[model samples]
Target: MTAHLPVLQVVIPLMAAAVCAALRPARVAWAFAVLVSWTVFVIAVLLLREVLAGGTISYEIGGWAAPWGIEYRIDVVNAFVLLIVSTVGAVVLPYAGDSVEREIRRDQIPLFYTAFLLCLTGLLGITITGDVFNVFVFLEISSLSTYTLVAMGRERGALTAAFRYLVMGSVGATFIVIGIGLLYSVTGTLNMVDLGLRLSELTATRTVPVAFAFLTVGISLKLALFPLHLWLPNAYAYAPSAATAFIAATATKVAVYMLLRFFFTVFGATFSFDTMQLGFVLLPLALVAIFSMSLVAIFQVNVKRMLAYSSLAQIGYITLGISIGTVTGLTAGILHLFNHAMMKAALFMALGCVIYRVGSIRIEAFHGLGKRMPLTMAAFVVAGLSLVGVPLTVGFISKWYLILAVLEQGWWPVAALVLFTSLMALVYIWRVVEAAYFHPSPTDEVAAAVREAPLSLLIPTWILVVVNVYFGVDATLTVEVAGRAAEALLGVPR
Candidate 1:
């Protein structure tokens, strides 16, 4: 049963999605979706525990041996990602019921849940699968469902955003597939571990670099990294609040994991760094993303769009850690991957609650929110502080390590730049805080009617808020696990 955890995590959601589409009643479909999401979350937790306790678990599909049969490989890196993706699904699905009902038509709710389940399954499958081709299949599964989910938004521009994302996402997927084909042509194996072993032998070949270029560009686009992030703000802004929260938290994080896996595990560190010099190329881009996006975030009139830009800046910090390419740096990068997920999810969910009651996420709409919806506004404040890297918050832990990583390289200027970006984060966050607490309500009627969001939304949002602080205060679990995961990727002996 334990050995089958990987398959169950993905299969449960995939099967539930099909069943959801067939189910007539929206309530029944939602219940089934919730059950499947929770099941996957449990499986992910179990998988993580097993990996931490006993190291990697490689399960061959259909009981066939690897190098021929497909593999579901579980290690610290992907197990952690599995936990992140599934946990987001588990938390968001419950809140989604209320939020989606308000935003999407009654008749569309069932289909919305179906697409949500399929997207969840795809993300989990992408993290768990060790077969290269399986990643592309799952990627498409998630992308298609995401398009449908985004298109279901009540806003008129949602269809346009969804269509634009569909076009960009499809092109990115094609690049990834072509890269995989190039790799397979040279190595003749689709299993990640096997490819890792064979890729080093062909490092001098021109095809290796070509494949790497394709993969880097493709994954960067998917992850919404800096210059390639044009599609993200519109996507997050126009989508339904629930869809925005879910995708903001999970989708790009999974793509980052895939990028880390391919660069560190499949390509191997020596080929990626020493021979190809990927670190030099990525480092500058990450820095530019950190500063430029934060500036853009400060100017956005819509709160959701502001957070979307902030999300891109946060991705920069994660990428910066990866570009450092050392054990400490990689640990920082991986830990940020988890921390950012929690913080962003909490922040977006808080905005979702605001949108639920106020029917808008504009910055001005937040005026006097503290007096009207104190609890919901308080949740937003806490998450905002976390985003600013306040002490005893998960965001601070990530930034601390990122700075330490730069210092380790004796790059004082780079370290200072990181601090500068944090100050920019502080400025934008303060803008929202001032609007929520200090400014008077635009209209007294809105102030009179506003109350805390329903418990359904508040609970999940606060759970993530509490986690942001809890993990910050006690960094042992994240630090240790990420350290081990980093060491493994760096080829250090256990």
Candidate 2:
């Protein structure tokens, strides 16, 4: 049982998701999802501990030998990713009951939970598996389920958002499959570890470069890396609040993990950065995304769409860290990955609470909300502060490290630009803050009817809120894990 924990981490959720569809009441299905998600989070915690105390844990499916049979590998880097995904699932599912009930039809709710579970399973599978093709397989599983979840939104536009995402996602999947097939044609094995070993000797091969190019574009599409991020804002704005919270916090982060895995673990940094000078390519894109997306966010009237755009800009921060391509830089990239998850999950759920009462997430709906829904608005403000890199918040910690990384590289202008963009974040956040606190409600009925969200929603949301502040002040855990994760990917000795 202990030896098989790696496989159990993924299998339990997959099996539970299948059963969730048949559950009688939607609440029961949600409860089942909550249970399985928390259990997986516990498993992730344990896996991270084991990897830290010992070393990488590898499990061959059905006890077959590696390089010939399927393998699930766990190491510092992916263990950290697994922990982030499962923890977000656990936090988001408990909040789903109220949010989903408000946003989805009663009849469709059970299937919604099933789809959430499937998405969770796919994300976990993508993080834990060692095969390149397995990554694509799980990527499709998560992508297909995500489309279903998005389409379940109450708004008619949800269907359109789902359709657009489906088209873009299919294109991404095709490119990834072609890339994987090309790699196999050259190296004759599908295991990522085996491919990495074989491809080192073939670094200059034309086939390797083409495969790398395809994989970069495919994975970039999945990560919503700038210009490719058109599908994200709508999927987030119109989807059921629970789906937005989960997808916003986890999906792109996992795609970024796929990029890290391929660039560092599979291709080797030398070929990726030194020979190809991928930094020159990625750095400009990251800078443009950071500025352009944030600029777009400030003009949005819908708060959810504003944050959706904000998410794209935040992704640029993560990519910029990666483009720097140093130990401190990678550590900062990975750190922001986890920190942004905490911030967005908290902020979106706060918005969900607002939606629960006001039935909308538009700027107009937020009028006088600070007086009506004190706790939810407060949570939003704190998380919003963190998003703007204010002191003693998770956002600041990420920025602090990110700035240090930039300065370490002697790119003073880049560091200044990072600060400038954060102030832009403040402007957008302040728009909602001012509307909620200073403006009067248009109708007396809204003020009378709106109240704090139910305790079920508030409690789970504040758990993340507490984590944001706690991790910010005492960042021992995230820093330690992110450092080791970076070391592992960079092949540095612990």
Candidate 3:
């Protein structure tokens, strides 16, 4: 069982997703999804522990050898991502029961859970697979399911958002497949390890560099990095709250994982940074995304859309860390990948709670909500504080490392901009806070009607809230894991 954990980690949720659709009563499907998510989460924990205790774990399909048969590989980097994705799924699925009931029709509920599980499976598969082509396969699975999930949103705009995402996503997928195909053309192998060894030897080929460019652009689009991120805000803004929370937390993170995997592992860090100079290209774009998107988030009427824009800015921070092209910088990027997932998921879940009661995530919908939905709003504030990089929160820990990484490079101006962007996060978050706490409700009837979100919703939201703080206060475990993952990717001695 332990030996097969890598395959099992992906197979369970995928097979269960099909079973979920056939289950009677949408609630049963929801319960089954939750069960499968927890199971996957436990498996991820086991996998992470296995990696930490030993080292890399590789499973060959049907006992076939590498570079011939498909392989599922687990290491500190992907194991950390698996933990993040599964952890979010476990927490989000539980919250889905009530939130979905409120937002989706009863008949559509099972379908929603099915799509969620499929998306989860795709993300996990993408993270664990060792084959480059398999990455494209899983990317499609997740992308197709995500489109379905987004289209299930209550608003008509959800369809438009889904369509836009599909168009952009398909183009990105095409580029990725072409990239993979080109690499195979040159190297004659799909296995990442085999490709890496082969690619290191093959030099001065125009094909490899072109393939690298395609993969970079494709991945940048998929990860919603800066200018390529137009699809994200609307997709996140109009999707079902549960979908938004899950997708926001996991999808782009996995895509970024693809970036790290390809740039650092498959291509080798020296070739990617020293030869290709990816850091120079990524650095300016990341800075633009952080400052520009943060400013955009401040003026939004719809809080969900505001947060959606904020996500682009947050992604900028992750890419910034990557662009610094140092082990500490890479560690900060990866660390922020996990931290932002928690903070943003919590914020979106809180919005789900608001939508549960008020049917709106517009800023005005939160008027006087501090009194009406005290716990939910408080959770929002804390998560918002975490987003702002306040001390004793996961957001702070991510920023602390990022700043340290920037300063380590003596990029003083870049470090100051990072700090300035935190203030921008604060300004946007404070806008919501002022409305919720200081302003009066439009009507007493409205105030009377709105009450706290149910415990089912509050529990998961607060679980993440507690995570944001707990990890912030004591970051020993996360930092250690991130550090290990970074060192492994950089081929440094642990």
Candidate 4:
């Protein structure tokens, strides 16, 4: 059973998704999803522990051997990622009950959880699989489920947003599958490890470089990297609050993991950074995303869209760290990956609370909310401060490492820009804060009627809020794990 933990991580949620779809009562399905998510998270924790103590764990399907039989591989890098995905899924599932009940049609609630579980299964599958082709399969599964989830938004525009995402997502999938096909054509192996080993012998081939380009762009689309991130704001803004929180936290992070796996592990860091000079492309994009998106976020009236744009900027921080192309840089990227998950999830969930009580997320909707929904608004403020990278918050931890990483590279100019964007984050966050705390609550009935969000919603929001601070103040554990994961990816000795 212990040996099968890698497979079980993906399997349990997948099987339960079918059962969830068949369940008659939406509340029952929610309860079942909560159970399945917690179980998957426990499996993820056990897998991470096993990898930390014993190193990488690999399991073959039906007793078949690797390169022939499909394999699920868990190492420090992906093990940590699996933990991120499952942890967010577990935390967000419990929150989904109240948020979903309010946002989605009552009859559609069961299907929402069903899609959520399938999305979870796909994300875990993408992270755990060792076969390159299997990544594409799981990517599609998650993508399809995500489109359905996005369309479940209460607004009519959700259908348009979902359709746009579907078209863009399909194009990204096509590029990824084409890249996978190109690699298979040259290497005659779909297993990632075998492909890596074989590709080392064929570096002079034109096919590999083309495949790399295809995969990079494809993944950039999926991860919502700057210029390619146009679909994300609308999708996130219009999606059901539960769906927005879950997908915003986990989906892009998983896509970043895929980019790392392909670039560092499959192609090798030297080939990716030295031969191709991938950092040249990534650095410029990262900088633009940070500065441009941060500016865009400050102007947003719709709070959800504001945070969605902020997510693009946060992705910039992650990619910026990766662009430095050093062990410290990679660690910073991985740390931000984890840290941003907590920050953004908590922020979105707070907005979920706002939307639940007020039925609106416009900045004006938050006027005097600090007094009306004190706990929920307070949670938002703390999480907002984290997003601004204040001292003693997870966001600050991520930036501290990023600053160190850039300084280590003697890229002082880049380091300064990072600081500048931190201010940008502050401005955008302050917009909401000022509205909530400083302005007067509208005299309208809805504004007057708004009260503190229910405990059911507040509990989940605060759980992530506490996590944002807990991990920030005592980051020794996350730093150690992220450092180890980065070293492992770069083949640096412990």
- After superposing candidate 2 on the true structure, give the runs of residues whose Cα lies further than 4 Å from its correct spot: none
**CA displacement after TM-score superposition, residue 158 of candidate 1 (Å):** 1.0
lDDT digits (tens) for residues 73-179 of candidate 4? 88999999999999899999999999999999999999999999999999999999999999999999999999999999999999999999999999999999999
Residue by residue across 1-494, what tens digits does model 2's lDDT show? 78889999999999999999999788899999999999999999999999989999999988888888889999999999999999999999999998899899999999999999999999999999999999998999999999999999899999999999999999998999999999999999988899899999884678888999999999999999988998999999989988999999999999999999999988998889998788998999999999999999999999999999999999999999999999999999999999999999999999999989999888988999999899999999999999999988889999999999999999999999999999999999999999999998767765688888999999989999999999989998899899898888888885
Show the colliding residue pairs in model 2: none
Can you tell me which runs of candidate 3 are displaced by over 4 Å?
Answer: none
lDDT for 35 in candidate 3 is: 98
What is candidate 1's TM-score against the reference? 0.98
> In angstroms, how far off is 126's CA in candidate 2?
0.6
Runs off by more than 4 Å, candidate 4? none
lDDT tens readout by residue for model 1, 194-272: 9999997764789989999999899998999879998899899888888888999999999999999999889999988
For candidate 1, give the lDDT.
Answer: 0.91
* Residue 331's lDDT in candidate 4: 96
Give per-candidate clash totals.
Answer: 0, 0, 0, 0
Each prediction's TM-score versus the true structure: 0.98, 0.99, 0.99, 0.99
- Residue 439 accuracy (lDDT) in model 2: 92
Q: Which ten residues in a row have the lowest lDDT in candidate 2?
A: 440-449
Candidate 1 colliding pairs: none
What lDDT tens digits, residue by residue, belong to model 3 across residues 331-439?
9999999999999999999999999999998898889999999999999999999999999999999999999999999999999999999999999999999999999
